[model samples]
Target: MSESAAPGALEQVRTFLNTWWVPNDTRAPEDRLPALLADPAAWQADLPAFAFPGREDAPGMAELRAALRAALGEARPVALGPWLARHPLRAELSADPDRPPLALVPEDGTAGGTILAAVAEAVRAGQWARLKACPDCSWVFYDHSRNGSRRWCVMNPGGSESRGCGSIAKVKAYRERRRITS
Candidate 1:
């Protein structure tokens, strides 16, 4: 897949969580995520609110991300209990008033909340185990294969420079193999 294609919600949240280690300063590991999200005008429709909290006090974003990354890397199903309390969703009533309540939505409206919600949704759909990171680039992507064994981001050979990690790693492996063989 080309880099231009936007990721699905599950991948979007995973990518967002991966940015916890990065601060929006020099754009090294990644751009200033918090700052970008702060721009309401920039947020595309259908995405969760961009105003996620992270300042002097930590919002558990990093820890949550680390735990998720570790579990995904190990190809295991993560128990959602520890995070449920902190990122609780508000129960919503149905419009008809005669029907049951609608699905719960995040109370805080922060990106972290959105991401966590996505994880919960994925789990319920039996798709959480398919959300994974590219070992070469740490970029999160969904494994759409029948066996759910896909690795590497969906990008092809000419993927943008910002996403050259997979290509670079492939080249390195090729060279190492050639050296060992010769």
Candidate 2:
């Protein structure tokens, strides 16, 4: 329960998806995902928060978050029935090897597997998108680019082309310049 402990497996997976794709201010280290999966209960108290900015009241989301946190903490993947009962997203996972495992895809897709597969393919072809955290929110996301030089969180409306931390410095410089001129 301590804040510094690693998150459980389900929480790790959820955190990876929620942060890696959508980008958030509260993402854990990328390596934490596999580590937590190897040991679900290795960290219980520090699991990432699952609440999205605009979807806190969505039906079943809270329960789903709790269930995923608990299940990933287990020694093994919990049965599908119980997991699905708490979160319908489990239904999107199929037995097809061609698809990505249910754990990888977002709910907006028909099946998580397909999206997962695409991510893998993109990664293998050296086409995997680079991601950067939001300077303000710390959200993670794939940076779609040929040169892969993106540095801002696309999910945030306020995100500027200038790097988050760098933008602050620019503002300070502008004010100092104006002060000297005046």
Candidate 3:
């Protein structure tokens, strides 16, 4: 998992968006959703909010994942209207006066609804724009920077230097510039 996860419920959206794994191996990168959906325990372990997903729900989950990837990665906007319409969340009043008055709940009690709800919440909090996808590796990461102008994933996550997409892309750009000048 990347250390650049968004704070609060937005972390769930970031986590779901980052499921498309690209390892540092020669083999082609792949989506981890299929394998994750096959195992119910894995679903609970990774996303407890998306609990008890069955094999039948795999297609929907995959579709949602793809739509989200496009929305995060591509220039064109992905119309999530149909999906959001299908999985609607109901507004509930909170018991605690200190807490926010309204809460959104999944009408269908599915993970998709929960994800959509989280997305809505993040948008409400104005943190949705901070979630970004790395151009080099297409990995989703949250920009926790104060200025909110962060465009790449960190080169070092846990203080040790690694070939994260940010450093790799900078190196490639540098090489290209040098090659042009030479």
TM-score, each model?
Answer: 0.62, 0.28, 0.85
Rank by TM-score, descending?
3, 1, 2
lDDT score for residue 9 of model 2: 31
| Superior by lDDT: candidate 1 or candidate 2 | 1
Q: Quick one: RMSD of model 3?
A: 3.0
- Show the lowest summed lDDT stretch of 10 residues, model 3: 156-165
Task: Highest lDDT: give the candidate number.
Answer: 3
**lDDT leaderboard ranking:** 3, 1, 2
- Model 1 is weakest, by summed lDDT over 10 consecutive residues, at 19-28
Instruction: Give RMSD to native, each candidate.
Output: 5.3, 15.2, 3.0
Ranking 2 against 3 by TM-score, winner: 3
Give residue 35's lDDT in candidate 3 (0 to 100). Answer: 70
Most accurate candidate by TM-score: 3
User: CA lDDT, every prediction?
Assistant: 0.58, 0.37, 0.72
Report backbone clashes per prediction. 1, 10, 0
Query: Comparing candidate 1 with candidate 2, which one achieves the higher TM-score?
Result: 1
Better of 1 and 3 by lDDT: 3
1-66: candidate 1 lDDT, tens digit per residue: 533222345656655555533222333465334554565454343234334354521446556666
The whole-model C-alpha lDDT of candidate 3 against the native structure comes to: 0.72
